[model samples]
Target: MFDTTRRRTLEWLGIGGAASIAGCASQAPTAEDTGASTSTAQSTSTPKPTDTDRVAADPADVPDPISRSESTHHDITLTTEEVVAEIEAGVTFSYMTFDGQVPGPMIRVRQGDTVSLTLENPPESQMGHNVDFHAVYGTGGGAVATTAAPGEANGMEFQARYPGAYIYHCAVTNLDYHISSGMFGMIVVELPEGLPPVDKEFYLGQHEIYTDKGVGESGHHGFSFENMANEQPTYVVFNGEKYPFTPDRYGTLSVEQGERVRVFLVDGGPNYSSNFHPIGNVWSKGYRDGSLEPPIEKHLQTAKVPPGSCFVGEMETPVPERIKLVDHALSRVARRGLLAEIDVAGEERPEIFDPNPDTAGSEDEEGSAY
Candidate 1:
């Protein structure tokens, strides 16, 4: 899948010519050129209250995905910083984050609401940063208006004119590198009537990590510019870490049987698309690319979530089982360390799923079906 996509990307780049992209990628921004303020007074001042303060105060601090509120103005703040963190047990990489988390905070608003967004590049950040919201309809999707340098900040106001889940990511020069390094998130503009409530909601972001080292290599890994340009990644992971959702590590997503679950997924791919699928379950209702219109695809086995896009899918857990979430790209799961699990706990429904039916009279107690 990546090979095909990489060929296409290369073809597109060749035909459109890489001159412009090369020019953009070549001119790395310097602190002076980025207009980072150096005033002593500004340096000593505290950060101003962001829009999130006025409304959804400190909502980004939590991991639970946020839901839409009543139609109104929303103030959202996103700060950019860089951190070195473990990608897996032994592998580590430098990540560019929003508000100190990969995939950033889930920003929710209703169609027709006004969004006052603030983008800040902290003093500790190493480069300039900006945001491009796929839901917006203006130049670079508000990127041009919101580019901020280290210690600097910028703001933009736009109406949430559409109802959908959209991808938002850093749009600075060499955006592919920035996004691949973990500088993206999702913004949900819900319909006026709102979506049907579910028993659980989980947010996940998918992005590939292009490291100079191979997977599982210990010690700090550095970004591979060559691999990124060729669309070859060493790891494709969820929530910015390898297999972080498994019970053996952080914990598995738990829910009762018969409960409805909604998974909000964002693919921050600087390159490949995601063939998002759950191993033992299907999307009972799917809002592809966050579309809120009628004719939502039902009972979908998998959905294509492209780079700079979002998907909202609901599942009905009818049986007690573990559902593995994966990118059907296969290689990502089989090789690149992409995995998540949802453990459904409740009384077993033998009528629906009988694992021991064939072994009822068998003498092989060790081989009882499960």
Candidate 2:
């Protein structure tokens, strides 16, 4: 089925590829200078098949929590590269990434630890790049210290003085363009003892993509500065693509019942905020804005995480069900394509939730309620 609602949203905003988009065919500096490859296709609402790669970082690819008791030194390296990847089955976009993934990789360290970070811009890169870490106490958060032009490398050392989760992103010129294109990630400076243990943990990033093309248009999409300025994102997504963690896409994030799960969410929004909520569950303990301080809030239904911020929340999966992670903005979920899912596999908790109490244990040939 076609997405009529999204189409209406475009119409209401007068966003059209040929008419309203202010920066039609205007690519980011890197994509433009490097002559990024794009398929030639007729603009249609229907998706066109693309051979491009995917940029969404696997939600399960989070670094293990710190296990050390004392402060230590760590070495980190981040490479800046531009990749042409698929936002969906048929649509492609050039993404600026820190190690070829959206939101890059999670950097984990103990509080008071010293970190030596290297930022590398390959010779083939068409633009300069640097990182501004929120956890750093230094000016520009090491942005000025690690600015690297193409074919260059820069390094800086900083101490993780505070204990909390923080965001790190490209802080080069036109950072909004770069961040919206996928150059952001999270860093966790944990207390000396580290965070409480949990059965599982997942890492995710939320950001918006502004393109001249609307939702389902085919062909390679270009970044739109005008749309970004207007704060009218063509897509608001988790990881890199719309509904990347949903069952219909890359498959739902799996968790067993009776387990406690931790989610580290980094909001990389160049604009807009995330009203993070987990359907079918609540944040049993939420560290507001990624704060690691004790006395975390309890039973938070939705947490409002703004741009360039982070949120760490825990959930208890006591029953088998599909819990949807969404931006409670609702319209973003319905139109802008932002969603994730957690599939809890275990016995049902009929005592808690029952959809068909009348049928009770009765089952049909399919082993489902009749």
Q: Write the per-residue lDDT of candidate 1 for residues 1-370, one digit (tens) a residue.
A: 0121222332322323334232245554333432332122112122222222111112113243335456679788888877766777655666788876778888877788998998877766677677888888787787766766666677789998988999999876668778888899888878888888788888888999887777776665767666776889989988778777776667777889988999988899989899999988899999998797888999999999998898999999989998888999988988887888899998888888876686586565574111
- At residue 5, candidate 1 shows an lDDT of 27
Per-candidate local distance difference test: 0.74, 0.81
**Residue 71 shift from truth in candidate 1, angstroms:** 2.5
User: How does model 2 score by TM-score?
Assistant: 0.85
Poorest stretch of ten by lDDT in candidate 2? 17-26
Regions of candidate 1 where Cα sits further than 4 Å from its true position = 1-70, 359-370
Give each model a TM-score.
0.81, 0.85
Tens digit per residue, CA lDDT, model 2, 150-261: 6677779999999999999987656777789899999999988889999999999999998879887777677666677788999999998988987678999999999999
State the TM-score for model 1. 0.81
